[model samples]
Target: MELYVRLNDSTDKDYAFQLPENATVNSHIKAIFSTSAARIKQRVALSDLMVIRPSIFHEYEPVEYYKSTHPGHLTEGGCLIFDYKADRKEYLEKLDYEKPLIDQLWPGQLIVPQWRMSKKYVAIYVAIMAAWLYTDLPDCISPTPGICITNQLSRMLIPILEKWGVQADLVNKLREEITPNYNSVAAQWAFFGLHVLKVLFTTFFFYIAMANPFSFNPIKMYKIRNVAITQKNEKIQALLKYLGWIGARRATYDDYQTNYYDYIIKKFGGVVQAYRAGAIKRAAAPGVPLGAGEGFQTPLEERFTGNTFKRIDEENPKFILSEEYFCELENNLKELLDEADGNIGRMNAEIRRFRRYGIYEPSEKLKHVVDVRKEIYIKDKEIAEAGKTADKKRD
Candidate 1:
């Protein structure tokens, strides 16, 4: 088979090869470097060689890894490129990149909610609320509908009681007696049930897909593929785009420093490639690689997460803390203080009234006033801390 190779170092140059029909990509790579050493010189390391078949679409072709194990993947008269790599050994032992990094899952099944604040969930909640409101059918303001429902039920039962030769007046009196006793109780339960239903709806709205809940591979095979703790990839976004949320879903963490090696291998092509070019380090400390260097570890977190923790706030410190945020905090603090003062005033007046009647053993209302004061104190301290933090930012 005749093949043309373009060197990474010399992109303008082309090298031709007449290799055996049974030749694999790994064998061809070695043959290129071995035979072309005279012409190519010591341009790249023996440990650093990769053969890539360029895609016409300007995207990476999955055919590179395939060419090694599947001979037909690189056919006769193929145009290929040679690039510097961190590993040759792994190239000979290729991974199957063709098996997708993720699988498609529908929302037919559900798992616990992991992500939140989506408008989709909000809309679903609204619809559920509407249905609940219609079915539960309030008769009064935030009503139990208990008395009204029981009255309508009793009206039908009263006629039956008349047929059974029960006194109508006695029956009406009995109905009136029980309804008064249980009316408030029924209202409280209705309110309680509303709260319970709200929690259930929230839980349901937040549920994730049942299988591969976090965008994991459906077939968990470790036989051929290497173990990896990969970061969230773009495959989910791509899947969502193609499937339009209806077709695909994501059920989308960390281990020791050594745990990231295979992920790096999977990502950048190999271990040496990762250490030299990717985020992995043979470190003396966490991020500090041993050139006898000092400082924290090279950030594995930042490498995958792109420095998400420490966000860049490019606002003026004084304007944000001393003016804007301070105002908001002050308003909240003032509101709590005012509420506490009002409660104290009302409780003191009631105490005065009780004392006038000579019934002054200190009631639950007085105790409640003290609790409100304590709550106010806590809120004040919390608000003060926000102010203090704002001051630190300004300073």
Candidate 2:
């Protein structure tokens, strides 16, 4: 049986091939790729390709000959259309081409626009809020224990806010509002002012953080740790470990050992003393000792010491593209250019033929042809430019 295959939507021409009567659709698709022109075959893989039967008005249905119970289901003059899946890297390259002028000219590292807040930032915010809520404030304004708490909290929050692109003016305002005052009247006002600022900042951060801008997997940290353990790259492992530690520290630290420890001791004596008193009370009771088997555990011992893998010097790392990848990109660009050129040539011939026969008029069909030709011309230029870029990269 003979089958007509259309690459892309070029229905004007078809590549015809003969196959056995019992051949499946999957086998037919593989044959189409294998037997088609080198340009088409090189750019597409069998796994990345899909076959569809085209119908009138641009509708299509999957030709599932592989699942068919009956043999010889494919009829004569039957047509199958092929299309390539969008390449993510190619999309990013195109994005680089179409970036805004301001973004292109911006100094320092370019941060791609994120429409939502990152989960990491949200986690950090929640941790900060938790620390604030659990820690107690002093009753008297003269001693200014509340002032110390506010200052310590502000110091911690400012860095996080700046990291997430909070406006400088707002950060400055936060610092100003939270700054401690010596006078009693002013100190009281400052206390209330700090509360208002915290509420405002928390609400604002929450709003922005609600939108997840990056493709961050929730389990990425665990994945990284697993990779670090298994992979031989020491530098990468170290980097991953460092990042994991930073995240852990941010989430776990509650100023207990540093800023808040003194306050806690002043209020409730030493933590050890409190723990001992609780233990004594629990000993007297028959119930499952209050909060038993809960609290901090000792740090786990490390297995590896020095770096095992070479650290990648990212400052001037060389990038080497695989020959197959380079060839695929080149062929894909050439195929696109050829398609556009063929389309333009065919449209030009049609227009000339109509004009020679005196059939050309200001009809919608002619106008459509002219518009299509213009579009083809633009596409041809873009494809040619892309092909040149690909060639340069290959070299």
Candidate 3:
């Protein structure tokens, strides 16, 4: 059998070899070394050999490499991609995944323009991220977060960015933004005012960066983290995504599968309340609830607390056999879950505030939210203070 074994390296060269059709993967490794000693000067052990289908990128998921062979896994006359574990370990150490996608791509998979990864350009992106993160630092330092002006005056600045090699996503935002309260006369004025200021500042900075690139460059001025930062920062959006109600697949909190999990949890108050009542307990054995005469008797006693597993005592996962019980539990669960609805309504103002004003802190914006009470604390305090003032006036 002849197989084209391609090395996923900068060379992008494929090693061709002829061997028995039934040869094992170990033999293939030896063949690769024997075929080309020029490239792989070091011996690649069978344990270290990684084999995959032809891939354009590593996250094309080289993670899904074939370690063991079964029928239909590898085929005769097919091209196979291979990399040594040691070489890949060194290769991976040099990549900064937090950087933009193009910067992080493998050298063999994508060729990046040297200017794009240049110190000046990378620093500009880094500053954009930092400014977008710590938005409370001062407006004079960073562009206002969500105020993208779609007016013709702002449209002119978009080209300045495009000319200076700014990313497409940031540039497009200038053309497409709609101020939230366009219906309100005051909001419209305020929106345009910020838009004008942002446009002037952005256009001048970019033009200077283009003209006197060496002088305007941030890289020359300061020592920064090695990782290249990305723009319009996704952290704020991700925080919203985690807490949003109409659940889509949540990329932010992946452990729970989806944002629906957040809805399920927060709707029920907190962790303890979420699973305590009507959780459809899997019947302790799916589709098989303990019979009336089986497992334990009716009117079971409460079990011990604080332990991860219960040793003894009884709590029925479901009614032994009663529609009445399920109906009652469902009604109760609905009432129990509805308590958090007020929490949802109260968050609307603050969440809306966050979108318009940007976040005060990077950590604050991205912090994982367990309950809704945290953000609405300001409203709670205001109500309490009003109550106190009313009491004083009565006295």
Candidate 4:
């Protein structure tokens, strides 16, 4: 039987196996781990398979290793992480108690309150007011009076007020307060302070109005959040694919990773490709020369002597190869090519879809190159129907 494995890490590293009658998913994992290079201290049964991690168990718990193991931190390879183990029956019972609507209220999903928005706006406004207090007075008035000083000051003040949207009417209002004969330093400071207050109050009022819950519609913000979560859900689906849990439908990671394009492409895609290539070569052609450049001798020399093909005949020279054997191999190759093409077609379709609506804007594109492999998931109902139809035909 073949079991397809996908990882929460979004890797699809599946393999076919000749299992004992009672082999379990846990046992299959252990068998794989025993031969792997990963330094796994514990088996974290994430969903259905044991995986490597040294410390953290559940999402509720903080990933303590992050502080020490952060790439920029003091540590080299980072701290170890662990997976949580669940008593299956108990865990299932607990999950059953959760309400449907309750499940929907994930963190970062809720609409932030209007009061919080208003408070933030007010805090920033206050900080700006504090800065304005330190800046020099607008030079509309004179500490010492002269024609040259007044004209120089007027030139500077006019541009500043115009840029700030303070009109000539506002200047006239200020000018009328001063005596035509003389201007004092105190009066200039008072005018500057009044202008600062006017700007602050006007801006704050605009912010408060925009942030009020009644006036502010959450629909746009909610759509952004919804899109984010939808992308997360796609990642979860891809992870299921990586762990080898077959889905109701078959689509390439390119089809799903449009949501979490970076993680899927950089993190998961490489892992899945390595696993698939390793598994296929290991199981299918353990002793076969992969290719001419793969450290094997010249193909011409290998064909007659030191080659997998030659060795097979040496082990059983009495067996004779006929037309039937070559025909079968040819058919198998054709089937493989057909499957490869199908996989490419699906991926191309997904790419086109994403190009039209892919929102990985302001980020790098995901590199999820498509490839084909034997799909092991067939619907049980479909299988049963086919079996019954075959039996009827035989009868």
Candidate 5:
């Protein structure tokens, strides 16, 4: 089973497998170290440490039996937790299995504008239409003037709609609905003419409102197209400073992406100690007697060296199994996963979910992850191939 492992202070997310029944801890560790020597070396001093665990059914037993000798074997992170609970067979097989908190949560994106359209902007649009309706005069009864006003308002609205990147056909239908009056050819012409004028007026004012140092008279600026170099340079510098501040953060040694597996192992002790005492079995005489087993034969001659795995028991105080901490952590992770899943699902559902709705443009962070995975995949494939070649040579 694939388990997501996050290392401390590292952007590198990795997946580790839960050893199947056929696989022994010895075989798994050896395989992992052999294939990923550099990565394993960075995280663990494999020669010293041993990783250990008991059967799933016997998880509650105290004093974990190690498969190898070691002080501790490094995990993906400084601390390790299973991210996907449903994938856990023991938990999933139960009829009462509640989905992990992580499964229900969503992760949000780092985006400049969280909203596609602002509420304030929408309110302004509505207010403008409402205010116009309220100002309709009592004496102006003719359909011609009404149609002219409606068409003019529509012409103004349509262009603004286009500028804000909305569908124009909808705006046109809205325009027709708002007018709801038809008259003579003269009225239609008046309406058309007035709409053209309103469109020009709205466009002009809109530009004025948005533009800095508004060029109310663009005709004059159009004639003098040659802009000053110093002015341009100043603008460029301002832009650079703006962007730099936005991107800048104080860097620290701790902030550097780390292999957490390496960090945990290093911090705990040397690799040999972790593995040898923690996991590995040294050959011992089967007849050797311990005080407790004086009357009976020892179940196994070899003892586990490393004590990596722990069982939840009464003496342990059940702190790790506490609902509050586990639930919180599980929920947080689930939220992140769910958010990613939701975004991808939404994008697929609505072809235009992201800017301009084109397929294959993922976030830069996602692209970085993809690149890292490719590198890891290539490295792993090479290691496997080399192992095969070495076995052949020995044969």
Candidate 6:
């Protein structure tokens, strides 16, 4: 039986294996590392591998049963996905439970609220009030001033009347009842009366400010809590947009239009790319090879000469591959190839459906599908080349 298998790591290459019907999924995964010419075989462990059945709408299922069983039965065009068990576990563990439920359903990190006001605004307010008190107080307090100064000064003096228990209601009532002509001598008296009333109101405001009767805490005034939270939410939304999570639709209050899977997809991309990058970065480290510069032959060259190099500590208790292992690997590889083909077909169908409906806008889903198909093509070619190399080594 022929099978298809996709490695969970960077390169994400799919390999084809020829296997017997009695081989188990576990044995098959181990055989790929032991027999294949792929470089990933050196980095991944058989114990950490999981085999899953790829599907369209449903989450992939792990093929725990043997190939001979009803549930474990492998079909043509079926795809068996291979991934690192540790990665799945770690991803699940890293989710932010403390965030609101809605935020968790969306892409982007949760923004925690830390409320406070900027020192600049606080300083500006203080400076404005200080200028009024220092620059205008003397003119208002002078004994002989012009009509405008006297009116303003009396307005400023209203606080003393209020503090002395004069009812603002009675003062306002008297002012309204008594009218004076501006051209007459009584106009000065009328203006003084109006200032006294205004002073009383000003005094009330001063009292309120000093005593804080409404409990308007100055410290709290400095922090625009609501604005801070809103700004943080917008910042996260902007970041998600940059990462391709916003999709074709503009982000809105409606959750249905948003593509929340970008974070997970990007994460998978990172995992797929990390191994090769890390290996190259850590090439000088103890376990990895220094390559041609160190006068050392590659792992594949050493393997052909019947020489065994020290394996990474993670793969210490390596399982020896048998004929059954190879058979199972081959069967799984066939399944993975089938799944990939099925996905391409489904994507093509969806694209056709959209076109039939007269929708010409480029769909994010279509783009993703096209990319996947391209990757599948590359992986299929790689699998064929690796198989040929393996055959040559055997010959």
Go through the candidates in order and give each one's C-alpha lDDT: 0.33, 0.33, 0.31, 0.31, 0.31, 0.31
Task: Name the better of 2 and 5 by TM-score.
Answer: 2
lDDT of 5 by residue, 170-197 (tens): 8767665555344455664565556556
- Model 6, residue 335: displacement in angstroms? 31
Instruction: For candidate 5, give the lDDT.
Output: 0.31
Candidate 5: TM-score?
A: 0.18
Cα lDDT tens digits, model 6, 74-127, are 111111112222123222222232333222211111111111333564465457
Give the worst 10-residue stretch by lDDT in candidate 6: 68-77
Q: Write one digit per residue (lDDT tens) for candidate 1, span 296-350.
A: 1122223334321122122210010112222333343344345556688765543
TM-score of each: 0.19, 0.19, 0.16, 0.17, 0.18, 0.15
Clashing residue pairs, backbone N/CA/C < 3 A, model 2: 116-211, 117-211, 234-309
Each prediction's total of clashing residue pairs, residues at least 3 apart in sequence or on different chains, is 7, 3, 0, 16, 47, 22
Stretches off by above 4 angstroms in model 4 are 1-99, 102-124, 136-182, 210-395
State how far residue 57 of model 5 sits from its true place (Å): 58
Model 1 residue runs over 4 Å out of place are 1-122, 133-190, 193-197, 200-253, 256-395
Per-residue lDDT value at 74 in model 5: 10
> 171, model 1: CA deviation in Å?
20
Q: Tell me the lDDT of candidate 3.
A: 0.31
Better of 4 and 6 by TM-score: 4
lDDT of 2 by residue, 277-309 (tens): 553332122111001111000011111221101
Instruction: List the pairs of residues colliding in candidate 3.
Output: none
TM-score sort, best first: 2, 1, 5, 4, 3, 6
The count of residue-pair clashes in candidate 4 stands at 16
> Which portions of model 5 show Cα errors greater than 4 Å?
1-119, 131-147, 150-232, 245-395
